[model samples]
Target: MKQLKSFIKKEFFHIFRDPRTMLILFGIPVVQLLVFGTVIKSEIKDVHIAIYDQSKDETTKEITNKLLSSGYFILDENLNNLDGIDAIFRKGKVREVIVFENNFGQTLGKEGTAKMQLIADASDPNIAKLAISYTTAIVNDYIRKLYPEMQLPMQITPEVRMYFNEEMKSAYMFVPGVMALILMLISAMMTSISITREKELGTMEILLVSPLRPVQIIVGKVLPYLLLSIANAFIIVLIGHFVFSVPVNGSFILLMLETILFILMALCLGILISTAAKNQMTAMFISMIGLMLPTILLSGFIFPIENMPVVLQYFSHIMPARYFITIVRTIMLKGTGIFFIWKETAVLIAMTLFFIAVSVRKFKIRLE
Candidate 1:
C-alpha cells in the first residue's frame, strides 16, 4: 500500500513538474470550450435577406415589417428589379431574396391568395433551409391574421417540438463532442508518449528492476493520469454547464461514472499504443493520426452519421467516440437514464476490456 501510494505520488509529481503536461491537463479543456461555445455558433440569428417587392403595397410592406421584426432576419438591400438578384447573391452577404408579385394586396383582398417567390443561395444548404422556413412561417402567420374568416373544411398545422436543444444552440452539440475529443486526445496521446519517453530514456528497465511487479508498475503509472483525466472531464462539464447554459438532465453521478469509464478505456488504448510504438515521436504520430481524426470525423462529432455513405457509416460504428458522444448527448440533453444508454455503455465496456486484454498481452511479451 505504501509503495503504490509512493508510485502514484511520483507520477503526479512528474506531471506537475512538466509545464507542457500541466497546460494540456489544466488549460486545454477551458480553452476548447470557450472556442466551441463563443466562436463556433450553430443557430441562425440576424440572417441578412433581400427583398424585391414588385407589389409595393400595404400587404407586402406589412409582411416585410413582420419578417424583419421577428429578429431572425435583417434587410440587406431592397431590389428594384430581379436582374440585380444574381448580383446580390454574388456578394454572398444576402442569403435569400423575397419577390412579391404585382398587385399583391389587391389579389389577396379579392382572391385571398397572392404568389411570392423565395430565391435562396444554396451554397450553404442548412442556412438556406432555415431562412426559407423562417420566412414561410412569418408569411403564413400574416396570412392567418389577414383572412381569419376564410375558413376551410380541413386545416393541418405541423407543430415542431425541438427536443434536447430548445434554442438550437450549437454549444449543446459541440460541448459533448469537445469533451470526448479532449479526453481521448489527452489520455491516449499523453499516456503513450509518457510510456515511450521512459523507453527512450532507458528508464523502463530500471523500473522493471525495482521491487514493483509489472502489473503494479503499469497500474501505478495509469492511476495518476486516470484521476487527472477524470478531473478534466468534470472541469469540461462544469464549464459547459455554467458557461454555455448546457443542461445535465440525467443523474450527475451516472455522468461522472461514465466519464471515468471512458477515461479508463482511453488509458488502456494508450497502453496498447505505447507497446506498439518504439519512441515518443512514433507514439504521438500514431495517437494523432489514428485517434484524433477518427474522434472528430467519424464519431458524428461534426457531421451526421446517417448522411454519410454506407461504408463510412459502418466504419464509424467502430469508433468509440461515436458511442460516447451519443451517450453524453442523451444523458445531458435528454436526461435519459442508464436504461436509455445501456447499449452505448455496453459497447464502451466491451471496447475497454478488449484494449486492456490486448495491452496486457503485449506488455507481457515486451517484458519477456
Candidate 2:
C-alpha cells in the first residue's frame, strides 16, 4: 500500500511538472470550443456577381439596387452588350449574373408580366444554387410590394441557366469530395499521430532539445508524409479515373500542384495538432473527432453546405478540405486551370501560413 501511494504521487508529480503537457491537457478543449463557436454560421455575404441590364429601366434599376443592398452579392461588372459575358466567365471572377429583359419596367407595368434571366456560373453548383435562391427571395419581396399579397397574374419569369454539369452527375460531386477526404486523413491525421507518438515515447523532447532547429525538425517530420500524400492524391485520381471512369478534364500539372498545396496545408495543420497534443491517443482523438469529421461532414463532401443549418455552413468555411474539394471539382469537372482555382488555392496557402505561424508561436511559448 505504501509503495502504490508513492508510485501514484510520483506519476502525478511528473505530469504536473511539465507545463507543455499541462497546457495540452487543459487548453485543447477550450480552443476547439471557441473555434467551433466562432466559425460555424449559415449565410453567404458579399459574393461577387455581374449584371446585364438590357432594359435599363427604373424597375430593373430598383431591383438591381435591392439585390446589391441585400448584401449577398457585390457587383463585379456591368455589361452593355453580351460580348463581355463569356470573357467575364472565363476570368472566373464572378459567380452569378442578372440580365433584365428589354423595357423591363414598362413591360411589367403595362402587361403585368416581364422577364429576367439569372445566369449562374455553375462551376460550383452549391454556391450557384444558393446565390440564385437569395436572388429569388429578393425578387419575391419586390413582387409582394407591387402586387399586394397576391401572386403576379403576369409573371416576371426568372430563367435560370447552369453553366457546368448540366446533367449534375453524382460523380462530379463525390469524386473531388472523396479526394479531399483521403488527403486530409492521410496528411493531417496520420502525421499528427506520428508526431505525438514521439512525445509518448519521450523522443520528441530529445528532438526538440537536439542540434536540429525546431522549424527544421517540423519540416523533416512532415516532409515524408507530404510526399506520401502527393502520391496518394495521384493514386486517388487514377482510381477515380480507371475504376469510376472519372475524367481528368483539366491540366494534370495544375491538379497535382493544387494537390501538393492542399497536402502542405494539411501538414501544417498536423504540426499544429502535434503542438497541442501530449500523446498519441489525444492526437488521434483530435485528428479523428475534431478534424476528420469536419472534413467529411462540414466540408460540403456529403451534405450541401447551402442546406446545412446557418451556423454549420459558417463553420464549413474554416475547413481546409472545403476549399480543396472545390478546387478539385473545378479542375476535374469544370476543366478550369489556375485562373478559375486561384482563389481557392490562395485560401489554402493563407491557411497553411496561418497554421505554420501558430505552430511556431506555440513552440516558442513552450520553450520560453
Candidate 3:
C-alpha cells in the first residue's frame, strides 16, 4: 500500500512538470465543445425576407407585421414589381419574398377568395422549407382571424415557393454529430493509449517505484489529455458557428458543463482501457475498435435510433457516446436544461463509476 501511494505521487510529478501535456489535457475539450455548439445546428432563424404587396391592403399589411414580429424573418426590401424580385434575390440579402395579389382584400370579402405567393430561395433547402412553413402558417392564421364570421370553403389560399437546400440538407444534422464522434475519439481513445504507452515503455514502473499512489498516477496522466479534449471541443463549436452558421440556442455555461462531464466520463473509460491493454498498439486498437466504431454506427449520432433495427437500438444503449451526444445536442441545439437531461447525466455518472471501479480493480491485480 505504501509503495502504491509513492508510485501515484511520482506520476503527478511527471504530469504537472510538463506544461505542454497539461495544456493538451485541458484545452482540447473546451475547443471541441465550442466548435460543436457553434458550428453544428439544425434550426434556422432570422432569415431575410422581401415583400411585394400588389394589394397594399389591410390584411396583407397585418400578415406582414406578424411575420416580422415572429422573430423568424427580417424584412429586407419592398419590391414594386416582379422585375426587381429576381435582382433582389440575386443580391443574396433576401432568402424569401411574399407577394400579395391585387384586390386581395376585395376578393376575400366579396368573392370570399384570395391568393398570395411565397417565393423562396432553394439553395439551402432546410432554411427555405422552414421559412415557407412559418410564412404559410402566419398568413393562414391572419386570414382565419379576419374572416371568422364567414365560413367559406377554399376561400383563402397561400402558394409556397422554395429556394436553397431543396433536400433539407441532412448534412446540417450530421455535421454536429460527427463533431461529437471526433472529440470522443481524440479525447478518450487517444488519452487511454498515451497513458498505457508510458506503462509499456517501463516509465510507469519507475513511477511505481517512487512515492505516489495509483490514483494520483492515473489523475496526473489524465489531466493533460482532459485539457486538450476540452480545447478541441471549443474549436469544433467555433467552426460550427462561423463556417456553418449554426446557432447556440442554449446557455453557453450549461453546454460547457455538459461537455466537461462527458469528457471526464470518456477519460475514465480510457483509463479502464489502459488497464486492460498491454502496450500502446493494443490500447489504440482496443480504443478504436471497441469505442469508435460503436460510437459512429450505434450511437444514433448519424442515424435515428427509432429507425434502426430493434436489436441495434438496444445495443446502442450500452454506448456512452450515445448518451453524451444526446446531452450535448439537447443542451446546445435544443436549449434544454438539467430537467430535460438529468437521466442522461445520471447514466454518464454511472458509466464513469463503472469504468473507475473496473480500472482500479485491474490496476490492483496488476500490482499484486
Q: lDDT winner among the candidates?
A: 1
Model 1 agreement with the true structure over 1-368: per-residue lDDT tens digits: 88888988888888999999899888887898788778676667899999999999999999999999999999999999989999999999999999999999999889877899999999999889989988999999889888888765597767878877877889899989999999999899889988899999998998888887778877988888898899899889999989888999999999998988898999999999999999999999999999999898999999999999999999999999998999899999999899999999999999999999999889989988
Clashing pairs in 1: none
Give the higher-TM-score candidate: 1 or 3.
1
Best-to-worst lDDT order = 1, 2, 3
- Candidate 1 wrongly placed segments (more than 4 Å): 39-42, 151-155
* Residue 112 Cα positional deviation in candidate 3, in Å, after optimal superposition: 3.3
TM-score of each: 0.93, 0.56, 0.59
Question: How many collisions per candidate?
Answer: 0, 7, 68
Per-residue CA lDDT of candidate 2, range 146-225, in tens? 76745646857576665566544455566687677667766787668767877789877776676656766666667666
**Residue 37 CA displacement from its true place in model 3, Å:** 3.6
